[model samples]
Target: MSNTDHLTALKDKIQAVEDGSIVAITMPVNIYLQEAEDMARCARIDIAELATINVTEVQIDDLQARIGACREVQSLWVEDQHKANQAEDLWADIQVQANELKSELIHTFRYAYRKDEHLMSAIADIAEGSTNSDTIQDLNDLSVLGKGNTDALTAINFDLTKLDTAADIAVNGADALAVANGSRQRGSDTKVLRDKAYTYLKESVDDIRAAGKFLFRNEPKKLKGYTSKYWKKRNQSVKKESDVESEI
Candidate 1:
């Protein structure tokens, strides 16, 4: 698909949230990844240049030494092999740094893309609305806008409260939505209120997932892997519980 089409599809997928009214939302992860790829490509090019320099420096050093060692030396060719060695060392260091950067870029891409998938799924869920009739009835009952003798003013106030709470959480959370906003104030800005609301919904999905993991920790279905630094720090209670159980 064309780039425009791809972006449109992505937007459509996200916009499905809240009966397609959440069109203001943008995926910060995707945006950041695109910029990161550009930066990584540039760094790779620089590394390639360093590699070339290393080869040229070594070759030139060897040529100069060969000529200097020749007899009938009227002109002295002072070959600074030390300088060439230093250049080789620097080039090796640059290659190592570049490789590390590339690995980091790959890891970041995987993480961000996974997050994007989750957000898209959440958006789809919100779009589908309530599937169960009983749940739908209950939601309609609790909805401030529904037929419960609630006037438009009251409904608007309730929505404002929900939106405000969501915005506050999104702004404080590590989700790319807030990061994409460039500044915290932008999240609260009138121009991006809808966008903030969309991000809040996205964060709600994260909260749900975290809660599920906590609740299902004892189940055998729980997969083992490296925990994120943030989760490792925050999930101390789980670790403590596990340790206590192991002792028993």
Candidate 2:
């Protein structure tokens, strides 16, 4: 029911990736936030050099804004995932009952329409697929088919009210599950925007690091502040493991 057009719009404006690969968070988001904070701090080392490339105080403020957006959206994603999970459980329960009803209708329809070529063909089409979505849609199709051919059902003493029940079940279940599915879909959309925000922040951080590294090329102490300690440790840890593997 909730509109996700805004989320889609935000993601498009970011243009994070051309290939559309917004996946699991690459690192803990807290680390990304801290990295942004540290980058912002180091950018102050030589604001003049950064300003030469238009990476001004306004850009720095925007970087913080992007970080804040990522943080807020990340919390909302957690809530959405929980809601989706609950809906999935409800859908599973409803599907079991729906499937049983569909099977009952199939067997009865075969008997009621066995002598009629046209009706049998319609029944055949309805009995085709084997998925939850198929079950939901079949209920709708069956309701229509049943109502249009009540004379056939009446001769067989079929309960016409079941048609109404079938139609209600189909409509209600489909509407509920559609919203749940929309929530599931919004998961990726939310991540796309969240991931794009991180990309935006990292781009600024990289810009600041590049300038800082170049400006402090002659000063090792200031240069340390320009680089990512997280990556430095990770690389060292990885190299240590590789060295042990080579020794083995």
Candidate 3:
């Protein structure tokens, strides 16, 4: 394959692994071994069939190098899957903390307001437009408006404005908390796929090793012996020459 094609294949494999579609390690050993051998055989045939391409040794070396670099990137990326859970946990904790603080603040405000009857009465007077002049009420009492007390009215208006502002802020903050909580939930949902990918990829290494041993148990076709050497040589050859990188 061309360098770009090779890298694309690797990317597709990694994506499949991450998305929980690649089941290389989950298949029966015999079947996996058979598929692997078939792939190797086809690869050899394809290389030999490319005899008419007029390909040069330098070009082959460069392609191999590119493939090696792609592999290094794939390895690093797969290894980083462990961090997915950490992020999910962090977002969950943040959501909890945010919600707790919001609830506590709201509860405290309600408790304080309910405990103070004078404060509530002032608010009620403002709502009902009560102007009983025989009693001296707090500035929040709308009677201050009838008394032509602009200063007290302004202060009451300011307090009312503050209440409105506080209500708006609380609403907006609740919405934000809901969104944050949703994000944490979504992250938790995708965690299963990530976990499966990590488990499958980790076990696949041992599975391949076992398959190699099983394949070589009876015969000496040298296929088992050449697995590492063949891929190493191919990588080195492709590195010396390659094509323009392509997006996945």
Best by lDDT: 2
Off by over 4 Å in 2: 1-25, 42-56, 76-86, 112-119, 129-133, 143-165, 214-225
Descending-lDDT candidate ranking:
2, 3, 1
Model 3 agreement with the true structure over 109-178: per-residue lDDT tens digits: 3344555576555444434422221111212222233233234335434333433333444444445545
- Report the alpha-carbon TM-score of model 2 versus the true structure: 0.68
- Which sections of candidate 1 miss by over 4 Å? 1-7, 10-201, 207-211, 220-229, 234-248
lDDT of 2 at 132: 73
Q: Per-residue error at 197 for model 2, in Å?
A: 2.4
- TM-score, model 3 to reference: 0.31
C-alpha local distance difference test of each model: 0.34, 0.76, 0.41
- Per-model TM-score on C-alpha atoms: 0.17, 0.68, 0.31
What value of lDDT does candidate 3 attain over all alpha carbons? 0.41
The C-alpha local distance difference test score for the whole of candidate 2 amounts to 0.76
- Model 2, 1-248: lDDT tens digits are 11243334344456655436444466688787777777777676567777876668877665556556666666677778887888878887788878888889988999998999998999899999777778889998999999998898999899999988888888877976887798898876766666776665566666777877887789898888787778889999999999999999
Q: Tell me the alpha-carbon RMSD of every candidate.
A: 30.7, 5.6, 17.1
- Candidate 3: where are CA atoms >4 Å away? 1-159, 213-248
Ranking by TM-score: 2, 3, 1
